[model samples]
Target: MNLIETTYQLNQKAKHIAKVVSVDNATMTNIQLRAGEDIVEHSSKNDAFIIVRKGKIRFIVEGEPVVVTPENMLHMIPLEKHDLHAIEDTDLILIQIKP
Candidate 1:
């Protein structure tokens, strides 16, 4: 088994960080965002889901706002257009699978 640490280990200096922690049958990415930062609007290239490790993020999906907190996880289908805004300092893991 391989263990990967989150923002604590990988994102100490940047406002936004995206790293592919694993890639075999699927890809696992560690993403971090500092308070007030946002990921530019884009489309999911593969089937994906986000596991929130800390703080909150607002997902704007096709203009609809969906707030996700530490208690929540968000999933998206391939090619879905979306944007992510950090409501607070946040950390998450994005698992994407090719379909």
Candidate 2:
């Protein structure tokens, strides 16, 4: 199992991201964001699983905004347009699978 500790201190800037675990050419990334941090509306070429590790995240799917908090997750179908926003200090893990 890939074990990781959520070290808040290690998460700085957050503009980039902190690598957590990846295998077999797969990519796993964890991002810590302060309140108000958000990604612009965009589409994904690969399917993505967005998990809320801490705090809450506000996401828009099909033009409707949905709030996902700790223990909550959402799946983005490939090439789906969406918007993601961090309502509060949030930590999110994004798992990407290459097709």
Candidate 3:
């Protein structure tokens, strides 16, 4: 996955912007989110986490919202639903890992 630069188009109707950075070993998937965008509440069987790489976010993980800025990290355990909204021009690192 180091060599595989990928992207997953989100809901255009919801205005979510993102790109898949890598999907390593099928157990870990890394994604990057763009500003003025959001990730709607959803969940998977795996554990999920996020790292704020740049800017800020009004992040909602498991039904709670918090302001997260650069260098901050958020984690969502297995089966947890979440949503993330960019509070400004921002970038984020999203990870989905095997339980």
Best candidate (score: lDDT)? 1
lDDT of 3 by residue, 1-99 (tens): 166443333323334334455355324344445567766787878776677666788867666887877767777778877777777655556676753
Candidate 1 local lDDT, residue 46 = 91
- Among the numbered candidates, top TM-score falls to 1
- Name the candidate, 2 or 3, with the larger TM-score value: 2
Give the TM-score (vs. native) of candidate 2. 0.80
How many residue pairs clash in model 1?
0
Candidate 1 lDDT, tens digit per residue, 18-74?
665656658888878787888899997898888888889999987889998878888
lDDT of each: 0.81, 0.79, 0.62
- Show the lowest summed lDDT stretch of 10 residues, model 1: 5-14
- Better lDDT candidate (1, 2): 1
lDDT tens readout by residue for model 2, 1-99: 656765674255655467778777557888777778888899878888888878888989779888988767888888889887878888788888878
Off by over 4 Å in 3: 1-35
Sort the candidates on TM-score, descending order.
Answer: 1, 2, 3
